[model samples]
Target: MNLPTASRQDGTYPRPQQLRAHWADLTGVWSFRHDDADAGLADGWAHGLPDARDIVVPFPPESSASGIDEPGFHPVVWYARTITRDDLAVAGLGTGRPRVILHFGAVDYGAQVWIDGAFVGRHEGGHTPFSFDVTRHVTGGAAHTLVVRAEDDPFDATQPRGKQDWHETPHEIWYRRTTGIWQTVWLEAVPETHIARLRWTQAGPAAVTATLHLDGHVPAGGSARVSLRFDEVSLDTVEVEIAPPARRVDVTVPIARLRNGQAARELLWSPEHPRLIDATVSLRAHDGAVLDAVSSYLGLRTVAVDRGAFLLNGHPYDVRGVLNQGYWPQSHLAAPSYDTHRREVQLIKDLGFTAARIHQKIEDPRFLYWADRLGLLVWAEAPGAYEFSPTAVQRLMREWMDAVERDVSHPSIVTWVPANESWGVQHIADEPAEQAYARALADVTRALDPSRPVISNDGWEHQNSDILSVHDYEGDGAILARTYADEAARRRLLDRMGPAGRRLLVGGAPDHGQPIMLTEFGGITYQPDTERDDSWGYTEAADGDDWIKRITALYDAIRASSFLAGSCYTQFTDTLQETNGLLTAARVPKMPIEDIRAAVTGRRKQR
Candidate 1:
C-alpha cells in the first residue's frame, strides 16, 4: 500500500478540531497485563501490575499490532505508562502554571484512570473521547505514573459493541473483541478555566456558527472573540459577551466570501469543492486577557433530503458510497496508524465513491478529518446494542450523544445514522416500545445536530427519516432494475422488503415524499487468492473477471434506475470471515484500481 507518510503519526494533536500546540502524545509502549479472574483491583495493581509484559498503546491486545495477539476472554485489562517533564517539553510545553489535561481519544467499554496511584477519573462509553484534569494529582515537572483499568464484558448484549464478537471465536459478521484502549492517548496544557468542548456548524449559506462549552460558569466580564479566514484571507473578528452562569456560547460569523451572492456557490463545500474555512476563537476577559483559545475549521454546506433526492450544498448529489466498518487486518478497529486513514479515504475516492457510510462504528476522527480535507461525504453511524432493555436504551443514548458531541463539527459528515438494520430494536416491526426506541435515536441525533439529514434506521423499518434507505442483496441486476422501474413498483417492493425481504417501514410512511436509496447491496464474495472456513457473502463470483462483471452490473442497476438517487455498496474492504470487499483486508485492491473505478462510476470496464 503505497501510502505517504502520515502527519501526527506519533499521535500528537489527536483531536485536530480542538488543537493545542502544547500537548504530548503518550501513545507508544506501555506495561500491559490482563486480569482474567478480575483480581487486579483487590491486589493493588493500580500502583503497578506484577509480571506485566510490554504491549503497544492505542492498539488493543486482541490485535496483532499490540504485540499481544491473544484473543481470549480477558474482560479486565490494565495499562501503566510514565509521562515525564521531558515528554511535555518535547511536545512544545514550557515551564508554566497551566493545568495539565489528560485526553484519551477512546477506550472500549469502561475506563478508570489514576495519576501517581491516586484515582483521578472514570468514564463509560467505549468509543467516545474523554479527559481529566490530572494537574492536582501530578507532581510538578516530574514523571507521573499513569495507570488505566479497562473492562469490557463480551457477553453484555445490552452494550453497543458494534462488530465486536461475544463468543470465544469470531463467526459470521462479528470479529475479534477489542477490550481496552483502541485510540490515541495524549495530554494538553490549558488555562485554569478553558474551552471544554467546541462545535462548528453551517448557520446559513452565508455564515457559520461556533459553539464553545466552557469548563465552568462564565466569569465576570467574559466575552468570546472569533476570527474567520477563507483560503488564507482573514475576515473581520467578532466578539460576543456571555452572562454569568452561561456555560455555552454560540457565536455566528458571516462568511465574507459566502456573502458574495452569484460567486458564493464557488465557496460552498461539496464532494467536488470541499472548501474549508479556518477559524481561531478565544475566550477573553473584559481586560483583553485570553482565558482560552482554540483553532478550528468549518465548511460552508447544507445537506437535506427533498423530493426523492439527496441534496448536498442545496443541490442534488449522486451519493456513490461504500459501507466502511472501520476494521483492519491487524488492529481491528484502531486505525493501524493515522496514515492508514488517509490511504483508506484515498482508496475510497480512487474507486469513484463520493461518500462512506462508516457503517456501525463512529470512526476515528482523523478519518473524518481526511474526508473533510479530501472531498468525500460521510454518514456517521453509531454502534448498536444487541438486545432491547431500559439498560440498553440508556447505554445507547449515553454513547450516541457522546459520539455526536465528539464528531458534530466535521464538515464531511453530512448524514447521521442512529440505527442500522434495527439491531437493538429488532422487534420494532411490531412492538411499540421498540418502535419508540428507534424514533428516540433519530430524535436525539437530530436534536443534537440539526444541520445534517438523519436516517433513523438504515436498511429497514424507519419510522421517522429524512431518507428511506434499504439494504437488499439481490445479485441479479436485471431483477433490481425491474423492481425499481417505476414509483408504484418501488413502493410495493419497499412495503415487502427488508435486508432479508421483511417489512421495510412502520406507520405506512412510504407515501411521504423523501429520497429512497439502496444503502447496502451487491456483496459479491470473490477471493481468488485465499481460502477460509465458512467465509460468506450475499453472492459468490467465479474469478477476478466475474467479480468485475457482477460489480459493474450491480452499479449499472442502481444507475439505470431513475428513482434510486443514491447508493452505498456493501463494503469497502474484506473484514475477517467476510470476503466481499472491493479491497482486501490489508487494503489491497481486489481488481485493477481503474477497473473498479469504472464499475463504481457506472462506466463499462475497458477490454
Candidate 2:
C-alpha cells in the first residue's frame, strides 16, 4: 500500500477533485524531537535538514507507532518537514497554476508556523483547522522548510483540556495528551482568484440557497457563474457578480432541477436509514471559464424540542443515547485510523442506541462525518475548564464559534454543550460565578448557531438551556429525593414563598415547555472473571445476577419518572481503568445484549 508524503513523492499533490485525498498527510517521515520553543518566534540554531526520524502522522510523538515507544514527554514539542512542488506535481499537482496553500487540520492547544525562517501565523485552539497562504514564501518549485511549534500546558487548568490529566500518565479517566500536530498536514494549489469558502442552506420548498465567498483579485468585468450538482442531478447554475476582493454572492438553485421526488427535496436523515447527497461546487467567470472546484456532502435533518418531546423531522422521537468518550485503546486521543472510528460507531448502533453524547472532547471532523452518514445523532460538547477567567472564557468561546462554523454542515449534531459537569453551577451547590458563566455561555452558543439547541451546562448546575439536561450518579437517587422533597416541610415552606422550583428548570421552559433528558445515568461496570463469561458485576465482582437486576431496576426507576424523557448509560465500553461501563473494555458485550437492549429501547412487551 502506498502512503502520502508532505509533497507527492511523484511531484504531484492531488487536486480538489480528490478532496478526500487532498491532504498530503505529512504524518509519516517527519523528523521529531522534544523542543520547548516560545510562542513568539525567537532566533535559534536548528538542524540543517530533516533527519530520517519518523513519527506517524496524526499520532503524538510519544506513541509507539511514532517510532518512539514511550509515554511521557515535555509539553513543548516541535515538528519539521520539507515539501517540494516537483514531488507534489508528480503526486497530483499536475502542472496546474504555481499557487499553493498549506493546511494544518489541527494542532494541540497552540502552534506557530514558520516557512524557511519567516513566521506566517499562529493559532491558539488545539481542536480546529488552520491554514496559511504560503504561495509567496515558496521559492518557485523549490523545496521549503515548514516548522510547527506546539505546546500544551497540562497544568493550565484554565484552558479547555478535557479529560487530559497531566500528572496521571495513563489512568482510569485520563488518556494521553496529543501534542503538536495530531491531524493531517497537507498542501494544495488553486487559481489565484478562486473560491475561499462556500456555504449551502436549505430554505424550504425547492429553494436551496448557495453563498460563495471569494478571495484574491476578482475580474472587474465578469460575474461568478455558480454551478452545483447532487449526483447526476444539476441543482443550480447561475451567474452572480462578485463585488470585490472579499465580497460574497448568494444564488438560489432552482427546485425543478432536483429531479422527480429527488430534486430539491428534503429527505429525512436518521440512524435507521442514513441518507446523504454529495455536492459539487464550481466557480466560473462570466465568459464560462472554470476557476475553482470542490466537493462536499450534506444530510437533510433538523432536531428540535416541541410539546415536551424531542422532535426530529417534526416527529416526536425518543433519544436513547450513550456517552462516547472518543478515545481508543490502540491510539488514545488519536484513533488508529478511519476504520477504528467506524467500528466505534458500529458498536454504538449495534447496542441499539440511536444517539451519542460526545462528552467534553471536541471529536475529529471525520467522526462527525461518519455520524452524519451513519445516521447517529450527536450532542457535541466543548471541553470545559474547572475555573472560568474572563480572558480564558473569551478565548474558549471564540474557539467554540470557529469549531461550529467548520462543522455546521454536518447533520448529526443536534445540540451544543459549552460547559460540562465541572465548569460552573454545582449540582448541589450552585456558585454565583458558575451560574453566571453558564448563563453567558448559553447566550453565546445561541448567538452562534440558533439552529441547534444549547445546553448551558450538561450536569450539576442548571443555569440555562433548551432542555433540562442532568447527569446524576445517585443510583436511582432522583426518585427518593423527589419523594422526600415532596414530603419535607422545607419544600412546602419554599413553595409557599413563591415559584422557586420553577427556576429549577434551566433555560426556563421551551416555547413548548422544557423536556427533561437524564442525559447520563447508570454506569454499572460489570467485569466477569472469564473474558467470554456472561455476567454483570458492579464495582468489584458482585453476584453476576445481582448486577443485571440492579441495571433493570434503574431503568424502571428512570422510566417511571415523568420528568425524564429518557436516559443514557454512563458509557458503552469500559474505557481505561474507569471500568464503570456496561460493555467490557474491549467493547465485548458483558451481559446478554438483548436484555439490556430491551430495557434501553422500551421494548419489554409492556409489563
Candidate 3:
C-alpha cells in the first residue's frame, strides 16, 4: 500500500499532469481583506488594500490554517500577493520561455484576478481550477502585485456548493463554507505554445493512445513527439505533426508488452500491483528543437461493467471502497498538507479498503496524484446541489465537465459520480426534467470519458448508471444478512424503497443485469472517553469493544451477501458532529488499527 508514485516526481505547480520541475509556490502569507460590502472595486482595493491582514494562501478563511478561522458568512473576500523578480528567475521565466502562467488550483464560487491593477481574467466554479498568462504584467524583471476577489453566496441553492452549508452555522451532513481561495496558487514558466492538456487512454491491450492539446495554434511546421517507458524500459517514441486548425493530436504508442504476448497483463494497474508507465510528451518545432515538454505517467488499466460484474483490466474486480468526505478538522475542505494527503490515503489502505469514494467535494489534484501513484482507486464525485433548477443544471454541467476534464488523466480514477443520492434531482422518480438532467449527467460524462463507469446518481434512485448502488444502514447484522442473502432477495429489497426512502431506480428500474454494490452503511457511533448529546451517528456503539463487535458484524454480513459486487463503509474518518467513522475527527482510531483492518478485509485471525 506504500507504493511509490509513478515518477516519484515533485508534485508542484498544482497541475499534476502537466508538471515542470521548476516552479514557484505562491502559498505563503498574503494580504487579505473581507470585502463584505462588495465595494472593493470602487474603493480601488485592487490597486492596494492598506488595512489588510495576513492570511495563508490556499486555506480558506473559515479554516484555522488561514490564520482567520472565523466561520461566519463572508460573501466577498479579497487576497493580494506579490511575485518578486527573484521568484520569476527561480521559476525560470524569461525570453524564449517568455510566458508566465499564473495557476490557481481552485477558488470557491466566483473569482476575479488582477495583476498590477490590470484585470487579468475572471472565472467561476468553486471546485474547478483555472489559470491565466500574465507575462505582459511581469515584464522587465520587476515584481508584480496579484490581487483576487472571490464571492460565495451561502444562500444560493442553485449553486453546486457540495457540502458547504448555506446556513450561518453548519448542521448535519453539510460543512462550513469555503470562501475565496481553498487550494494552491503557483507560477510556472512555459513556451508561448505548450502542451496545455495531456490524456492517456489504453484503447487496447497492446497500444496506448495519447492526446495532447496545445494552448495556442502551433507554428505551421510544428511536430509533437511522445515517448513512453515502463520500468526504465523504452516502449515507443511516436511523433505527429501539429497541423493547423487542429489543436489536438492523438498519437498511439504501441506498448511492447502487447506484442510480447501472454506478458501483456504485466503492466496492468490494480490496487495490489500498481504498475505505471512513465511518459514525456514534448512539443517540437520543425527544426526538431524541443519547444516545451511535460513529464507524466499512466497505468494501463481499464474499468467497465461486464455482464453483472465490475471489471478491471477486463476481469471481475470488486471495489472495496470507503467514503471520504475530504474534510480536515483544521483545514476543512482544504487539505492540511501534501503529507496529510498521503497519510489519509495510506490510512484508508491500512484499513484494507481498496478504493475511496470522495463523498461530495472534488479533491485537489495533489491528492489525486498520490492516489494514482500509491495505487488507491478513487470515485471522483461532484458536489451536490440542494435544489434543482435551470441554473443549477447549467452550473453543474459546466463545473462537472471541468472537473472531469481536469482529472480524467489520472489512472487511479475508476468511476465518475456526477450526481449522488438525487441531491439535485430529487423528483426524478417522476419528473421528466429532473430525469433528463440525471440522464444527461451520465451521458455527458460518458461523452467526455467512456473509459470508466458513470454513477449518475450514486446512492439509490439511480437514473442512469452502470452499477446498482444502494445505501442501507440496518445495524442488525442478522436482518441485514437475511435481506441480501441471494440475488432474488436482493431484488426484492430493491423492489421497494431503499433505506434512504428512495426507490432503487427511477423512470423505470434497473433490469437487474448490473452488479449490486452497497455504497453506504454502518455509520456506527463510538465516542470513547468523551460524550456529547450533539454528536451522533446512524447507530450508537457502547464502547470500543461494542464498536469493534458491531463493525465486525456489519462486515461479516456484507461478506456473506451473495449478490454484492462490493460495499463501502459509511465513512473513513469522523468529521465534526458525525461520530460514525473508523477513525476519530483528529484521525485517532477508536479501536486497534489492526482490528479495524481485520474487519474491513475479512482477514480475521484464527481464534
- Clashing pairs counted in every model: 0, 21, 0
Better of 1 and 2 by lDDT: 1
lDDT of each: 0.84, 0.64, 0.85
Candidate 2 lDDT score at position 356: 91
Best candidate, lDDT? 3
- Name the weakest run of 10 consecutive residues (lDDT summed) in model 2: 1-10
Candidate 3 at residue 490, lDDT? 74
lDDT of 3 by residue, 211-251 (tens): 98888768878988888888888988999888876888898
Write down the RMSD of all candidates, one decimal each: 3.3, 6.0, 2.5
lDDT of 2 by residue, 217-256 (tens): 7776546554544444665566666655646777666556
Residue 168 of model 2 has an lDDT of 43
**Model 2, C-alpha of 86: deviation from truth (Å):** 5.3
Comparing 1 and 3 on lDDT, the stronger one = 3
Candidate 2 TM-score versus the reference:
0.84
Cα misplacement distance, residue 106 of candidate 3 (Å)? 0.5
Q: Sorted on lDDT, highest at the top, how do the candidates line up?
A: 3, 1, 2
Record all residue pairs in model 3 with backbone atoms less than 3 Å apart, i.e. clashing.
none
Query: What's the TM-score of each model vs. the native?
Result: 0.96, 0.84, 0.97
